[model samples]
Target chain A: MINSIDLILVLILLAVLLSLGSSRMMALIKIMALQGAMVSLVPIFIEPQARLSNGGILFFQLMLLIKAVLIPGLLYMALNRIAIKREVEPLIGYHASLLVGLGLVMLSAYITRRMGLSLPGDYALLLITAITTTGGGLFLMMSRTKAITQVIGYLMLENGIYLVGTALTKHTHNIYLVEFGVLLDLLAGVMIMGIILHNINRAFDDVDTAYLEQLKD
Target chain B: MLEAVFCLPLFAGLIAFLLPVKLGRGVLVVGALLHLQLTLLAWLSDFPPLLPGYFSTAPAGILVLLVTSFIFVFIAPYSIFYMREQEMQSEPIFIGSMLLFLGTMSMAALAEHPIVFWIAIEATTLVSAPLIFVNRSKKALEATWKYVLICSVGIALALLGFFFITLSMDRAGIDVPLTFSSLNTAAKHLDPLWLKIGFIFVIIGFGTKMGLAPMHTWLPDAHSEAPSPASALLSGALLNCAFLGIFKVHTLMVLAGLGDFSGSLLIGFGLFSILVAGIFILKQPDYKRMLAYSSIENMGVIAFGVGIGGMALYGAMLHLIHHSLLKSSLFLSAGNLLLGFGSKIVAQCGGMTRLLPRTFVSFFAGFLGISGLPPFGVFVSELLILIGAFKAGHPVAGGLFIASLALVVAGFARIVTSMSFGPSRQEILVPEQTLRIVSPFALLLTSAVLCVWMPEPLHQIIINTIAVIGGTIHG
Candidate 1:
């Protein structure tokens, strides 16, 4: 029986593919926002045993706001600030990257079955989506030249890792506090990256990482 | 309380961000002094955790905490003088970020819970990013970007690794609280397959931050581009915090009877880092970048020492202490040279023996100390690790280790010699100041003193730290 949890995981996998194939920076950020909102909802649906205490509900709301709204909003502001509306010239082409994204799903499924952990219900789907999202995010980082897009890549990577954490660990531990800390770190990391991105734009007149090659040995 | 060690710096840092520039400088120094005092107090007596699940002091962590605090005490004062000479545009931010970086590192040292440790480690990366970009040059911007992006990605993998460990625990049907101490106690019961997988991720993740090669691409750029005082802290102190993360997980692997697998992996990465550092150091154009590569090499040596276990693990602990002291001192000396000549390129500025004699003395002494010569703690530690490698039946790795060390020394000597004595007569920009000169000398002296005679308590602490992994001082 397919449930809402499995549905959310599949949507996440689709978001990963869209992010990889999308050429415009603004569209990539939007995909990340949608992926973030969906990934944060997985924990609530997957664990039927975890009755939503007051704290848990509050935690989920905060996670939703930060992951869905606050982070993408910051990226949106950063994009406007840079005023670079041109298409990204990826090292790998959009079609090729989309193919790679599809490949990642197949590879992740192979790995999930090979591990043979016997996860209950559709949790295996959660694992596959998690791995594919992570791999796709990494691939995005390598293929893109612009720094802002790379940061978007990082956000995807982070969301994927969050899914992995939710899938593997039991919620019996008072994990809210720890998870909250991780979220805070992610928010701060994005802010810091935004500031640096602004500076990079100011200095080089573009966020192309190729301009950053001056310091290498 | 244990919490105060970190809390004091976090608050002081926030205050420093708002205070006047002069006042911020004072807070930087005063904050370091107070932090050292609290760390000493924590060392002398037990401070039970305010939050038992998140924060606690273990022997190894306290050792790292002490080293971090001791180095900051000197670097903070040195930064005031260094920044004044540079006429920094963002003095308050630099000062504030330094303090915050200290606080985050202290928190990482004290973190008992796995997630708390990850948060602290990740926070360190975020806070320290500003330190590298304080100069605001194009190169500095590039360095800061790479440092943030690479370390963040690497550390995120570490979070995944922690999840795997927790998964292992769930599979074993054990329900212990998620702390390193608790994990160590229940380690023998963990499924070896998951445990092994987790160890690989943790090492690679933390290893990236610790400046192991392949992942060490960011270290040289960031270190050389930062203001020298910030570079000193990044090289001397920050790397150790990352190493502590790997060390904790390695202890668990050993307890779970998977030492051989983890140890071999460590040895491989360690030797590779040394080889990589040696190749880059030989033709290195920038003096600061050369020092940064040397840092990578020393970190490799420490990793190799710990991986060989037995006496080598004991040597690794000693190496950790001396490397922080000696490498930081070297960076401070490099800072003085930068101020004197206003250039990072070695060929552009020369005759340091004539133009900047005081800096030449400390710089030359630092070169000797770091090269593992006599009267320096690194010498003793490296020797012990070498002997242990042979005794532990890793003679081939031992031979590769010595070859890499020789290559590193040869490259290092060429660079240092040219800088100190190579023929050039450029006018010095800023003459050596007493305040600028004292800290490096003091740090080098501490390393030298420890080499000859370690205090009894420090020796005992080193013994306690290594013993958890079956390391003994006497082979």
Candidate 2:
């Protein structure tokens, strides 16, 4: 019997799927936000003892607060400012992307189960988070037309990995430092990328990657 | 002072940033010199006291720090020339960012812990993005975008790999310290499943940064699009930083009794990288992009050689040095040509030799050096790798290596023939302040000369570092 709270994980999985299949760039960014929130909750659902580390509940919630809520919102605002409104027709199309994402998820499950793997904790939520992150990142790269979307996909991928980290590993100083570094770098990256993308759109009059083939042989 | 080498650059980056723009370049040069001296000092003396925090280095990072510092030294005069006539206020910021890139790489090499190394790797990606867009052009932005996207994904995966290593160590009841030495000692007892999982992520992660095939989509674009100084450092030094991380992981795998599995996987990617370069080079239309493809190929060769242990790992180490020297020179000369004649496309350009004599000579010298002409550093290193390949009883692999290399040579020859040999198509003036582009070319000549001249001091440095790396992994 599936517990009611597990619905959040299922819905996150659904959001990951929708992000993979969506053509609307704006909609995909929103889906990314939902995915982030879902992944952040993974720690509580998966890591038990960690649930009590110095108001650990709030601390664990911070991962979602930053990763899920903050990042995607930042991305959406970037997209809005850039005014790059269009359906993302990936070099590879949506139907094929859906097929690949589905295949990868199934493969992850099959591979993990067959490996006879078991962690110290419940890890079921953590496992699902990892697979979702990997699959979503792959999908984002293949499914998005804009460079911004691809970066957002990469962020989603990192968030998924962080979910695994916080959920499974002991809360060490080094881990926290790694987490902070990752977030700061990713944020700085987005800011730098936003400036560049704005410049690209202004210069080329079209941020479509087709125009980028000038340097290629 | 291993710790000092790391600490100084970080301080220097901030120092360089705080200095005036005109002084910014000089400050960078001083910081590099100080950093290099300290690294040399560390190598000569006993291990530097490990600062009780997250960062440190071993015998390995001393060599990494030295090589990167030398590259900075080489680029200094060149950057002085490279940045001339560049716009107003952004100059300081740009130079500051480049210093930060070096500082981050320094921390990475000097780090004792896995996470510090990962942060450094990711930070290099962020710092380098602006360098890609130095010209503020549409094309530069696209290249920068691709670079940011691909490498970000790759490094993120690597960070995940770091987490996996931590998890594996935890499973082994090893107290989960996450230091290189600690992990190395416990690696043999780690759960094979977790170790394998960690390795897959590391390979994919670092492999992207190393410009390995499949993950190499960003390399050629970023290389061709960035200014020459950035391209030279990108190919010469930056890729090496990523390769060092991968090398450390490979060493850990060797200790874990997973040497064969990891080696086999590396060889697979290495060969694929060469094949991709071969195909790309054959049809390549842009001369700069062609050089970029060649970098991918040379890196592929190193990866393949490293994967096939025995004499091969030593060969890969040697190849890494040679590739850095020759590739930097090649890209620098390419930069000279682009400035002299305003085009990277092979078909549009002609008679470059008559118009730009010194640039032509530099280009030819770089070409000869990179194409493995006898007496050039690349020739010696590549020949060693070929011999290593044959000794490993992989004649098929050897043959493939030879063929791929030949394909690059012939393709590049066609590019050079059209671009540098014919009659003067027009009067080509060198860019206003590009006189110092010759520095990288001069450095290349020096490196090539060392390969033949084999001075005792230099020989000691190269041979000892190779042995240090090889001794750890060779069964």
User: How does residue B215 of candidate 2 score in lDDT?
Assistant: 94
Tell me chain A's TM-score in each of the predictions. Answer: 0.96, 0.83
Task: In angstroms, give how far residue A47 of model 2 lies from its true place.
Answer: 4.0
Model 1 lDDT on a 0 to 1 scale: 0.92
- Name the runs in model 2 displaced over 4 angstroms: A1-8, A18-31, A44-65, A86-108, A166-174, A204-207, B1-20, B47-53, B85-89, B431-438, B453-475
- Estimate, for each residue in B225-314, the C-alpha lDDT of model 1 and write its tens digit: 999999999999999999999999999999999999989989999999999999999999899999999999999998999899999999
Q: For residues B169-237, could you state the per-residue lDDT of candidate 2 as single tens digits?
A: 766666746788777777788877778889899999999999999899999999998888789889988
Positional deviation of B279 in candidate 1, in angstroms? Answer: 0.9
True contacts kept of each: 0.93, 0.65
- TM-score per prediction, in order, is 0.99, 0.89
lDDT of model 1, residue B195: 88
